[model samples]
Target: MNNMKNMKVPSGGAASTLAKLGIIGGIGLYAAANSLYNVEGGHRAIVFNRLVGVKDKVYPEGTHFVIPWFERPVIYDVRARPHLVESTSGSRDLQMVKNWTSSPYSSFAWPATYSLSDPWREL
Candidate 1:
């Protein structure tokens, strides 16, 4: 018991310093991860800034970077989709007519005057 009393106790200063450093490192890693975005093939992306509205430029396939929390990337699929349309109606001669159509359609050709505020609504 006498020998135990002679031992010195360690201080908490070193542990507190290490904890502060760990917190800072974790925040830095999180910011870095959130700053990058990827656009896959047949897809596109657009930037929306918090301060301003949507950016005018569209990003193609690949990786791009933006400010974390201040800007966001909105990805869109521009690939063509197949659609089938069928209809049945009476002809000018009072005869029954059946129409069947299959075509490839895509929204990528949307007019330039389209609004950027809510792009998803247009789709």
Candidate 2:
């Protein structure tokens, strides 16, 4: 804990795991490709920092959405990232093309759910 002797935690409950972390760039969520929070029980301090920026990130896996034992649980963005590819070309299935799910034109509908096309728009 000595290393974190000068670290700071959220004051006045401004930081809630249950609450939205922040709105960045636009209305986008505060998503560092990773986050890290160091805790010190003796000093009653929690030092939360983004691992993505750390020089040698201990949390290689990026664990920011953490639920403290006493406080609210940090919320993970289960809302998958979206991509919207616009093309006048023919649909993918017609050409047997496979795009990364992150592709924009990937539609999330009921069709891909109940069948092989669930959540996907195959031409």
Candidate 3:
């Protein structure tokens, strides 16, 4: 009968609804994953926004959260590490002066000392 045919449900409609739900769920999961992150020990992180510049607050070692696609974290190691300071220059005497110094976190350089002197003295 025409009435019975009209009452029948379209099979494709149910499949389409389920497919849409699945896609939405997948997107939600992806966003949630991106919103969370962890900072390891001896490290710090800075929160940043797409529209704003670096935030003033620094996050220590721990778990943190942010809005996906709108914000991000930049991690930095606060631990003391080795660094080399070096330079080369040609003097008025037609002599080449080269010097280099290495230290852990460059202990000598901390509170950085600067002076104008003969570069050859450090060589």
Candidate 4:
């Protein structure tokens, strides 16, 4: 215990330098981790910048990068989905008429009109 007390600890500059390095390293690590994003299959991504707003470019499936906090990714499922509609009413002859419709719906073409900040707003 007496021998351990004899060892001098870093007093000022060295300690401060280590602290600075640690903070910078932590910030860098966080930025690195946040800068990357992935878009899965059957999905598409759009970039939204804090300053300029949603960009015109769309990212395809796989990995992509953006400025950490300044930009964000909005993902949308573009795969075709089945939709069904059915209606029953009386026709001009007073006879009951039934109608059924099935369609494939997808949002692949609607990204251009979407706004990241206000999802309901049009671009």
Model 3, TM vs. native = 0.58
Better of 1 and 2 by TM-score: 1
* lDDT, residue 32, model 3: 86
Report the CA-based lDDT of candidate 1 relative to the real structure.
Answer: 0.79
Q: Which candidate should be chosen as best, given TM-score against the real structure?
A: 4
lDDT of 2 at 17: 33
Please provide, for model 3 over 4-37, each residue's C-alpha lDDT reduced to its tens digit, 9 standing for 90 to 100. 8789675778889999999999999999889999
Give model 2's clash tally. Answer: 8
Where is model 3 more than 4 Å wrong at Cα?
1-12, 82-123
lDDT rank order: 4, 1, 3, 2
Task: Name the better of 2 and 3 by lDDT.
Answer: 3
RMSD of each: 7.0, 21.4, 11.4, 7.4
How well is each residue in 1-123 modelled by candidate 1, as lDDT tens digits?
999999999777988889999999999999999999999997778898888768878788999999999999888776666676789999999999999876665244432333433674344
Write down the TM-score of every candidate: 0.65, 0.17, 0.58, 0.66
- Clashing residue pair totals per candidate (backbone < 3 A): 0, 8, 0, 0
Local distance difference test scores for all models: 0.79, 0.33, 0.73, 0.79
Model 4, position 76, has a per-residue lDDT of 84
Query: TM-score for model 2?
Result: 0.17
Summarize candidate 2's per-residue lDDT along 1-123 as a digit string, tens digits: 886997877665755533544434323322332233543221112223243221211221233344232222122122234665444444756664444444533454211212322212232
**Model 1 C-alpha RMSD to native:** 7.0
